[model samples]
Target: MHKKVKVKPNSKQQKIEEQPDGSLTVHLKSPPVDGKANEELIKLLSDKFDVPKSYIRIKSGLSSRQKLVEIDKEG
Candidate 1:
């Protein structure tokens, strides 16, 4: 199954969680600009799950705090 996450950029502590509505909540230290936050998110998630960066994708909310990301099952 895929996880839906809320992206929180520029956070003091980085974390990720599954919300009640089946969404993910992430705390990131990267700023939400120039795709930095998104890049960090992908990198973090990929490492967390032991997957390659190319296996993770931002399905939606690219420019917002709430993001829908798709993690490759085989990744």
Candidate 2:
């Protein structure tokens, strides 16, 4: 399933919190600029969901605090 994530980067540790509106709060140490934070978020989600990294895609919010990701998996 696809999920909407709000990214809070440059933190001390990485964390993921799922909200009631089907969104997520992702925290990572990588800075938000230069795509570092986005990369970290994708990696974390891929590992957390046990899905391939290729299956995780940031569909929106590249330059914003909020993001939309599409998780497409095939079995």
Candidate 3:
């Protein structure tokens, strides 16, 4: 599945909120540095989707707050 995620880095807590438009708003504790935020996002999505970390990939916007992520649940 493909998801549009809006990432908010350096948050006090980590959370994922689903929007009405089928997108996601993710609040991450890690700062957007050296891919830490991206890693956190993947981990959170993995847990939410009951998939392994390897199943989640950031398809686009690697360096931006808005990202397109792919989750392969069949894996």
Give lDDT: candidate 1, residue 31: 93
Candidate 1 lDDT over residue span 1-75, tens digit each: 467778888899888776788777889999998999999899888988888899898888889887678899696
After superposition, candidate 3 runs with Cα above 4 Å error: none
Q: Count the backbone clashes (under 3 Å) in each candidate.
A: 3, 0, 0
User: What are the models' TM-scores?
Assistant: 0.84, 0.92, 0.98
Model 2 pairs in collision: none
Model 1, TM vs. native: 0.84
Error of 2 at 21 (Å): 1.9
* Per-residue alpha-carbon lDDT of candidate 3 for residues 1-75, written as tens digits (9 for 90 to 100): 999999999999999999999999999999999999999999999999999999999999999999999999887
- Writing each residue's lDDT as its tens digit, candidate 2 over 1-75 gives 889899998889999998998899999999988888888998999988999999998898988888889988872
Error of 1 at 2 (Å): 2.8
Clashes of 2: 0
Better of 1 and 3 by lDDT: 3
Q: Give the per-residue Cα lDDT of candidate 1 at 32.
A: 90
Best lDDT among the predictions, by candidate number? 3
Candidate 1: clashing residue pairs, number: 3
